[model samples]
Target: MSKLGENLLKISVILMVLLSLFLSWKIWTKPANHQFQDRTDKVKAVIQKKEMTEVYMPTKLFYHHGSGDHFLYTNKESTMKSLHEKIVSLGFGSSKVLSTAEITNLTTKRDLFNLVYPSPIPISLFINMNNVSATLPHDSKNFLFNWLVMSLDDNKLYFVDYKNKTGIEFDIKGNIASIASILDAESNNYVTAILPTDELNYAGIYYLADSTKLKTYSYIIATQSFTTFSRGFFNQPNDLFSNEGENLSLSNSEGESLTIDSKTGEVNYFGKLKQDHSESINELYYETFQYVEDMGSSLGNLRYFSDTGNEVIYRNYVEGFPVFGDNMKGSMAATVQNKNVFIKANQDTLQIPLPSDDSVTLVPTQEVVDSLINKGVDMSKVSDIQIGYKWQQNKETQQAIDLVPSWYVNYDNMWMTQEKLESILVKGGHS
Candidate 1:
């Protein structure tokens, strides 16, 4: 009786263990169902994710000799990307404030390489907005500057505001052998440029010295995800619905709305905002990052174009030139109203580059400015002037666009073409 009972108990125990193992294998092999939004986020993740430095990169790079002449490398895209990685890899040491006089004096004996940002970016903005852990120091913690210049002579880097004439300076960590090799190798494609010292009318803007040829590109464009925007810009995603009108109107019961223009494919979103301080630029920066997870658009090389106190703008760039147009062609904006934030973008973004045989050569910046002044473009209203690729439709196809290089005048921070300004002046109307 004892032997049979013991054997039966052993058999029962083995069966129970086998059953548990079978159940565990089933749990491991069968896929767990995910929620709808979670799956949507996974799809978005495949397309959208960008670093702040990746999006807010410097627009221009200049190699300056000891004699004070500046040169721009024509191999822009590859050169800049490699150089950016190298500089950040070396990181930075302690930085001290350098007055304009100090910078000028220091430049007298140094070979300078400058990386010019489109706008003065603050350190706090990167930290609060994108959680960037850059190698900036405590002394240079919050310096605001648009220019990041490298002094190869002293192995130093200066982050300076050209107009303000003040910036933080930090000594370099290593020798300039790597930087020198790249510059020397790419010297074949270097082009002459007019900096602040060369031309007064450049007005803190850099210009190509002569007429240059640039390729025109065509792109297959698309829009930001409606699902992502609803979750982000609205109070509740489920409660938000749309109306089919002239514009595709999106709204929730919580007084937030976003409208997409059907004809032009422009997007304008409005939402209630709560910030600790009204004048805090950092607050706006954080809000900008929260609503838009990534500044990236498909097939678009977007960078920071400009920012006023109340708004920030980013535009798609090709070979160092910003693309400008109202049909949203790749322009993005974040604006802060009194108690609300307005996020505006084109319903379409550049997706795929198409083949193009088009190219354009425009007159120099000085000649363009002179023509504008002759045409009665009021100088007082013009805050900044720049060359941009005017985004237009291709006559043959609806799938692509023509990017023509043209001079644009920024009227109090608003950009418009020279022809538009001339028309306004002719009509006795303000631009």
Candidate 2:
């Protein structure tokens, strides 16, 4: 063959070979339906091996333990047990089982992931580790460990850093007022807390790589007024409690209080109080005027008998009682004396007198009257009155009455009823 013909023939053969190679590469790398199915199967195998019976396919796992109860995902007993084991394996120490309610009490939006174990201490200690999944500016290797030290009932989220021995609390915004290091991130210390800006009027969870530095995350829905009768605090946008009219309550380590709202679950008002006050204070204060529903029905005759019973029945109506503090047995009292309502705290017999036709006047000691005057409390304008006190222990029956005063005002004409009077008495001295 001629030289030119030979060269052309070689070039044609090489072109054909290149075309075949390109087609083969595309066929080999393309993903198929079967391949996708195989990947799903692998994931299922791992889940099965872990014995996770209640699997939320698309949901991220949430775990917590508190007040002798353990919770994971939802309030399922089986899932709680599995989570307990997983936490133990992850280096948690001896733990006592806690109820789902208790676990929820320990968690906040910033918590991301947590593992709490029941303890005798007034506050429960749990490993509050930053959830890499929930965090922004994501780093694959950075790990943060924080000790969430909080009272079983207090709304304060205290972040304790054992390594650095320093902490800050994020009140209400991220469960507590402080965020310390429970785990280290990037060999440097990281802290978490809630930061509130007056411009926003809402609090956001912040992560700090070091002192004086911060990275803010999503805004947290503070517990608003009128939604204080439920069992949980700080519901997420996606949480079931986020729905309107979800029974909710506000609480601190010291106590819990109830209120009702017909509006949405988002905390609308920042609460009419100072920033230093605990978040639960608003609920506790509001509860003083609120009546507990079905207390007599739920506890039957036992509701009015025991000291704890009375407190429990009236807790939703009192502001001073700790939501999660020691359950002290006591009696509450309220009365309208003269034009002013007088509330006194003592362990004594409680007697609430009926409304009288004659004008009643509360005669506080001159010292107390002076104090009220200093604080700008207008005694002359105060016509409606309430009183509450703790009953004293009696040696005869081995019983004592601890009275707590709570009262409220009637929306109509502002006629002071005994119920409102009692709540006011408690609210006056407690807040």
Candidate 3:
């Protein structure tokens, strides 16, 4: 071979060697947070899959006597689930959009009791939750309602899609007398709470008419094994590997990964997911439910909070109020990306309730709002306000958590502690 040709061949070989070395270094130094290395065994924990009816039940229950103030089911454990099941079982005859005149009267009229969800949900899902899987029309599958209203004097039922200021009417299909009795009996269980159906003209927010005290609770927590996540998410758990770090990260060659925080027991998982672009709203919910069911663990009464088009969030509800925090104490979320699914779940969850005497006295809703405004929070910017439990984890141990009663407000679409919102808006507040 010519000398010049030999020189060119050597240069090509050197270039090839350099490319290989660069690739090796990139893989070697990949951040430990998501480094791809070892195999994990299948870890199984028995957490029963919840029925659609249980998780998707209403979050709020209120009764209106028409002439006077309304009453709220103040018992911390929500009575809405039992109510929802009864209503769903009773069935419906027809649905129609509420007339403009009727929609206008929703706030002023006090003759109805309603079950409210945290956000809008399709009517078909409501029906399916009853365990009656019937094919529904496109309208029912897509029509969403924030609350289901039932007439106390009359047996008429309505599903209000608050966003559209429209609603569908349904004839109560079952025994009207039985339904009436149930609502009537609730009078004994409800606390006299004032809903600003007069001035603010909204029925969503409920204010305890008098000073009432709620108890705080501590719970012994239990976390699912890291391997449970790996086995549930990845098709091949044997291919995933983990290291001894503060966070348990399991990865494989197939591009699926799981990261679990050792302290908080929060989990972040990314996996190859195939979703049908044309799937109906009902299908989306069903599939997500299956995914949650597949991943077994100790989930404390997780209830569907909302679906924000981008993601679906389920929160932990205790004694009728939801527990909230950045950590996934009683929460799990599912999001679908292009050809992939990302899930955020918590391994650590509140389990056994510990005996506690801690209790907090919360003022009336009007007072809570007034105080917030006095503290410089712009009430107009506040879209939502309610009471819920704030999860406070014990710093000393990972196995304990405290649920503290606190006020939460949706400020400019962001939900935060009333105190946090106060701090943010204290200086002239946000417009």
Candidate 4:
């Protein structure tokens, strides 16, 4: 070959080798967090487009941890109008049985849609008591109400028993907050103590009525603790995210005295309300999930856990699992006086991918019960047993958190964690 041709050939070979090395380096050194970039982008797109995330209401054999055995039944045409009709017909107090075919079709549609669509759909399942599945283990004697409302928002699935004639409601964060509207007039005025619960957290305010005494009650159930406030008063209309998306400001009618960090949605109001409580703690919990005004992020589901004196505590649930934080964290508390509702939430969300269901093996209910009984727990006294995820601080990486599967036993006044519940099964022992 000619010398000029040889030179060109050698240069081309060198360029190809350099390009290949660069590509390899880029692939090998890619950040671990960016692995799910495509999925994250799609989620962002869906949010920006305001796409109606399909909400599935199943009507068939359903088996999950939260709700025992319940299914939604409808004989009307398959349309959104029909769905609304079903909800309205069940208004106040109503009960009726549905046929097997209706349930089968509903169940089929749900399964088929989920299988075809990669994106997740928020689902709420309603189960009637009279027609619960025969194969499912049930405690009819232990039943608290006639209907069960099971809701799935993002990763968390919450189940609560509802009495006949009660309407269902979802908070701003897409959690079941139907019970929040119920007013315990006695507790609202004079509540000194509140125990923890497996449900979402809550908070509110009350007038002690000792020469116009006011108290702000806050509780964090995951850690089983409460925060209180003495007599103090702030001016009316302490607006927080009122005008579309505005940060909260506190003042005594002069000007802005204290401006809360809107991102965290923090508030320190221990005063009386100028207006009535338009929204309960449950409503505030839902609103926080949608927009935090100055806070540039949304939160996961915050389910109602418990309430004490005019206050309620709700916990954050991500990907259908409960998140655990220190006493100062883990849950959101609210204080309501007259109609003024003050919420204290310090939780935030990250757009990270959730661990696959296959990665976490759920502990069976029976096994959990057995473990509790072996641990000397009185089954009769045990209120609720739920399988959920708890966030544990990753000691190896500061500021990083790990979601660990946990068995939470709600007994007496607090939530008990039996980390060793899985160990018994691993050791091949079941009495």
Candidate 5:
């Protein structure tokens, strides 16, 4: 009886050990196959989802550079190569300074361009109301030409075509026509031909219409009505007066004086000014924001662009997107010094309405980069690639401006739009 019992117990113990080993092996192998299948399914789903929702708005604003029209890059690599070649052709050999057309191209959306390159002002405004449309390097040989004329009687400005003798009146108020170079204040007659430089600052100039010779004069007047002074020298407003049609001079008995634009009201103060406080760059940035807030203007965030000895530049963001004006100098600007700060903010005048839906599905950043590379963007030459918003006017009106998502590539000392780059790449069969 003892031998039979021992044999049976030994067999049962062996059987139990074998069963446990089998179960362990099965558990490990089964889950491995299942996990692999699960990961593969996820990868496929992501690919399909991206394909389904890839369409985006192509509303980015495009501009022309010198010898180039308000052009879009139809071929990526060639277009970029073209711009790069133009820059290299200048023979500066790595000089960062661009041409007037190139700088105009870079600063066309100065508010956003400052994001790509850097500037001294902290915030820029999207100014479309004052912008006039004309081809770059205004060709004198063109049959049709444009000129700006001021009617003293109505205190109005107009864009006139000499060929057609037609003029579209401007809605500018105030008696500012005298600020132009060619104005007859008594007779209410002033007119000037548009120049390339005028396109930069949108300043006032006067031109006389003489068949034999075209005479021109320029004017800039900056004004200030101060409420706060860093120094305790309280002065009366009587100190300020128009020394000429284009100049408004403000002088204090202390020998300090300021000159301002009579028409645009732009002011530049010279001489010793007192300072109550000196702010760091970050502090100045916050101060600029507070200045905008105090004016009860629209809500927009500031992204620092650049700074110099006297001024700092920042780009304005609304709903977390950058606003683009005609050039990158920005629409909003401030002059902060040791003792006094002067801010000229244009947001109060812009009429940008948010999109019905603020959300957008952007193309993946990597894919965008790949597209750019294919279009001929030398990654080595690109200082940076950034995502921001560029504002575009509809029907040349600021009231119907659209803030669009955009990709900016800073290369060859210029800021170019992704739409221009993509078009070139896609046309090259890279899309």
Candidate 6:
């Protein structure tokens, strides 16, 4: 009986050990092929061929920041050689090896001729001659011309005539006669005429107008030409007097004074002045005219003049009416009079007294106090509720401040005003 039992037990133990080893192997060496496949599908769903095409692919443009003239062309060798030749022809020195990323950065800093992809030749050569002119030596005949026959974007082949201060724009549309008439009219006396050029697909001419026999500039931007007007006495005339204009009685630190006329845009100047002045001069401050303007259909022109030193006194006008009126329009009328301050509104008044600090204190209303008492709030334990009200409504310090019991040094010594305490208590429905 004992032998049979021992044999059975030994067989069972061996079988259990074999089963445990198999399970451990399966868990440790299992392939992660399903996990990899799940990740691949997720990436495929998010990345599409069309979306990838929108990304900016590397082009054949190269840049060389070294001392020598070098550039990188297309990704292809044949295309690179052709672009190299074109760059040399454009007076870009010589060509050398450069990286595409470097070329992109250079293009952002300075305009470069964009080349056609797959094609070795540069399709469009862009020259920012406006910025280039600053670096080049100034010459009367210095001009930039584009002989390239191709066109891309808004770029067009044209020649700039810096000698005559004229630009000939090509590929222009519309009737040239109407443009010529408008240019001639606004050409002022400085421009001679706007003639049409004989170039194909191009129209417009550059004419030099007389400006009192003095040479003046006529700026040409695209299809427009701006003729500068010469300075004349009538150009800036004096301003008219008006009410609603700022009272210029205040002393100005700036010496310049303004005179304006509302009937027309006329401005006059009284130059600069100094600061120190006696009572006699101070009395004349009201009579002193700082600035005038006629506020017609517009908000009116404002003139700033100096009464003393270099400080400017701003004066505004209301429909070209002077603020003084026949009489002093109550210029210095005292609207508010208090023990500590006198407030007045005047066109040319100065030196008014400011409100005193701590003039008003916020206190809880009597009603609130009564309610607190009814609520069993110990007056000895509760701090006095002070209500601070600004005597001057315009004062910025009149903001409400919360007065908790902890803010008071002695709860029993709460010294809130009767009026404020009553107001707070009544508003709280306690009184």
Tens-digit lDDT track for model 6 on 98-178? Answer: 233432232233222222221011111122211121122234132322111112222322233221233332342223333
Candidate 2's displacement at residue 194, Å, is: 5.3
Q: For model 5, how does the per-residue alpha-carbon lDDT over 1-431 read when each residue is reduced to its tens digit?
A: 36667446544544554465466446323321111111332332333221100111011112222342222111122222232222222211111212334323332221110001122121111111112232222222122212223333334333333223333333444323223311112232212221122331122111111211111111111111222111111222233332333444445555555553434434344433233324342445443433333322222334444444555545554433345544332244556665565544331223223223334445544555567766775555554454555655443222234455666655544455777756654677322
TM-score, one value per model: 0.78, 0.15, 0.81, 0.39, 0.33, 0.15
lDDT of 2 by residue, 1-431 (tens): 66677547545544554565466446434432221111332332332121111111111123232332222222123333343333223322222333344433333433344322110111111221111122112231122223344332334333333222333333332312222222212222222222222222111112111223111111111121221212112111111112223433232322222223323222211121111213332222122212212111111111111111112122211221111101222222122222121111111112221111222232222333344445544444432222222222222222112222222222222323344334555577321
Predicted structure with the largest TM-score when compared to the true one: 3
Compare candidates 2 and 4 on TM-score and give the better one: 4
Candidates 1 and 6: which is better by lDDT? Answer: 1
Tens digit per residue, CA lDDT, model 3, 128-219: 56664344434566778887888755566888865456777766666666655666673446777765644342334667787668899877
TM-score of candidate 6 against the unseen true structure: 0.15
Worst 10 residues of 5 by lDDT: 50-59
* lDDT at residue 391 of model 1 (Cα atoms): 86
Order of the predicted models by lDDT, top scorer first: 3, 1, 5, 4, 2, 6
By TM-score, is 4 or 5 better? 4
Runs in model 6 with CA error above 4 Å? Answer: 1-134, 137-253, 269-431
| Better structure of 2 and 3 per lDDT | 3
Candidate 6 achieves a global lDDT of 0.24
Top candidate (lDDT): 3
Put down candidate 1 lDDT per residue, 279-362, tens digits, no spaces. 565665555644454433442666777778878777888767888877665777878767688887775666556555567777
Clashes of 4: 35
lDDT of 4 by residue, 78-141 (tens): 3322322233233232222333443222222221111111111112112221222222112222
